[model samples]
Target: MHFEQQTPLNAFLNILFDRYQEKVPAVKKVTDALVAQGVVKSQQDIVNDHIAFRTLGVPHLGIQSFEKIFLHHGYQKRDYYYFEGKKLNAYWYAPPSDQYPRIFMSELMVSDLSEQAQKIIHRYTDPIQADPVNGLNFNDGLQIGEFFHRSLWPLPSKHDYELLLAESEYAAWVIYNRYYLNHYTISVHALKEGYNHIEQFDAFVEGLGIRLNTSGGKIKVSGDGLLKQSSTVAEMQEATFADGETMSIAGSYVEFAERLPLPEYADMPANQLTPAHRRNGFETNNADKIFESTYTGQTKA
Candidate 1:
């Protein structure tokens, strides 16, 4: 269901989360486990730190085009991040108000890829001569939700996918999953007693049989130690390719983040703190590893 004109921001976000949960089994599984452990009374009590999206650096799309939806909904561009190893550029947007989650959008530098990889990507995207976002009904929440789940290009052949995977797993993921929700992070610090930190929550999740992404260690902490993050390895789903072949591939997963209160606010009572009182932006070092949640090496059974 889409959000109506009078829908509050919290209600609109609830709709998005419901849609995401329906498509991403990992989200529900994790949420259910948290509830069972008494970390949260229900899924609604789990504060979302942020949600991320992956896009291509093609002509019509990219962060430039995709960000309009959130911008129209009151988000403002904030910090810019660069991932040299992955050839990616990203930005984290601040929500209009504290009640909303932050946004992280990343785009692949297709030109940075090898010629063979670029050609394969262009084969599907080259057809669209104009920016697709121009046609979106930004005021219609339902339309925007569908846009997030819609496929912008045809499926790639398994061979082409493998080629892209060899060079950049990020490229392979965006090419096939196009516009799919990458992951939604739970604000672990906001949880009830015993599970308010990443260490505690990570162990609790693992106890429920969830495998986490361990590329840069299971828990990626910021240099300042104010932001800690962890994510489950993506669950595999069968994806049908252009060649009529189907294979199990990694889909979306869930993430947990514990944004510590700044040193100045460490002694303040919880009621005195606000969104700004905590670590408010993302950490590149931590995010770089979080992106590997969908890599074949990490997702393969």
Candidate 2:
């Protein structure tokens, strides 16, 4: 039997330390809370304190973009839906796999209308209750509360609903999908030895063959407004692999993008077309690099 050990002096290690530097207050607060509850002993007990991680939530626009991108690819679309009064949408995608870990795309509307959506963004921006046991303070904040482009996964579970709900109605809807995906764990580990690790671990139904969603698929622009497309586990038509082969592998059909074009719903209520960034309590554009949206929504965790 063989086991892989940690990579030495890797990018993950640097990220871990950077995360530590950035989220000290939150870490300390959490640790202190744990210590107070007698779950932890001291601040030193916070092992691998340098590691940073994130939990991303899916947006409505991302879901639409994903549908278009995937259809452009080759994966077959299993199902799709649009919710009324709740600028939310979802779709299921799968490929040829003995174990299909279905990919779900969800879009949350958070613009001029819903106050619930606004409140969720606020909680994400502002984390309350600090922990002093680990000397943790609520500082060196995480922009997660801020609105921008990101892909998150292993959404909040039933138990996490209250916490997520307390944050935003949109989050509540986003996290509810966790039950369908077995509430997997997504940890961004900046390894102590080195190497940045973004792992998505979860159990998919055996023989159900699921594929990772990508953006190489062709686009089918709607004559009117909505775009219609499909995806397959087969190779992308114009896709070329670095190894000099067609880009049609098992998980080849995916949805990814540097940005999501805002939808124009002139016929629909103006409140329905509100952009998520507007409701997201955080700044619109913070990073120099444009964050790409993925069909795998919020795997950034």
Candidate 3:
């Protein structure tokens, strides 16, 4: 939501919310308690609604080389999800307007794991022989926002990230967070009304003591309940590994959608509705429990 327009899609979404709010401290402890509880007026009046990534199906990378930087800035590629007990594989694009923010992106079926987890994910994506976004320079929007924080390989040994977090905590988070930005959504029916639904924004994010990803309930919905999600459980962050040692792992989180409206636009006129009468895309059982907002069973429940 910080787009001051260096435009290559606002410098790839302002360098992915400035390095995902610096490794996600519940994203500025919930955007500074939603700008000190007035809940709107900063963090660009919050309304992102989508921004996820976590790939590594191996060979040059996943989700077909990380959705060619938002399908080369015009997005589009919708639907198609598949979790199947988290072997994972997903999609959902549709941006190119509505001032951008809709992209999901997932992957990690590195041949459905276990051959010692595809030989420890081809031992760090087998030295990525090619397609690091085809060696970038994709019309430089600050070099595609620093090619999503570069470092495309090597650096995974905390016993190979707890042996790929015991076989797939989404492949030990894309083999040590390569491509990082793994969550950022917050479009609670465009707020401004008692925090606009998601059970009143999960009771204003559990009255700011935060920590909500209760796996399948602290709100999820969407079986025609018109999309209502919740998240915020992945914020551990210390990590050094590559044998140097350091620990606190999990790292990113902060989602809270709502969407609604579309029961044939219910009664429209929520200011004559926009974002096309709401309830759009995403909901593979509410994103397979919002990908366990960075697992370890919701970051240790």
* Candidate 2's TM-score: 0.24
Q: What is the lDDT of residue 34 in candidate 2?
A: 41
Better of 1 and 2 by TM-score: 1
- lDDT string, candidate 2, 1-301, tens digits: 0012332222222333333323223233333554565544764333221110112222322444334433432435665545544344455554233111224444554554356555544444234133211231212122211111132232223434454444444455333322111111111121111111211110110112333222332222233312222121211123233234432111112211111123433355433433231111111121001011112232221
Candidate 1 clashes between residue pairs 3 or more apart in a chain or in different chains = none
Candidate 1 error regions (>4 Å): 1-15
Per-model CA lDDT versus the true structure: 0.85, 0.29, 0.83
**Candidate 3 lDDT:** 0.83
* Stretch of 10 with least lDDT, candidate 3: 3-12
User: Where is the poorest 10-residue window by lDDT in model 2?
Assistant: 281-290
* RMSD to the hidden true structure, all candidates: 2.2, 22.2, 16.9
- For all candidates, the clash counts are 0, 48, 0
> Candidate 1 — number of clashing residue pairs?
0
What tens digits encode model 3's per-residue C-alpha lDDT throughout 14-117? 87788889878777777788788887768888889889888888787888987987898889998898988988889999998987789889887888777998
All candidates in order of lDDT, best leading: 1, 3, 2
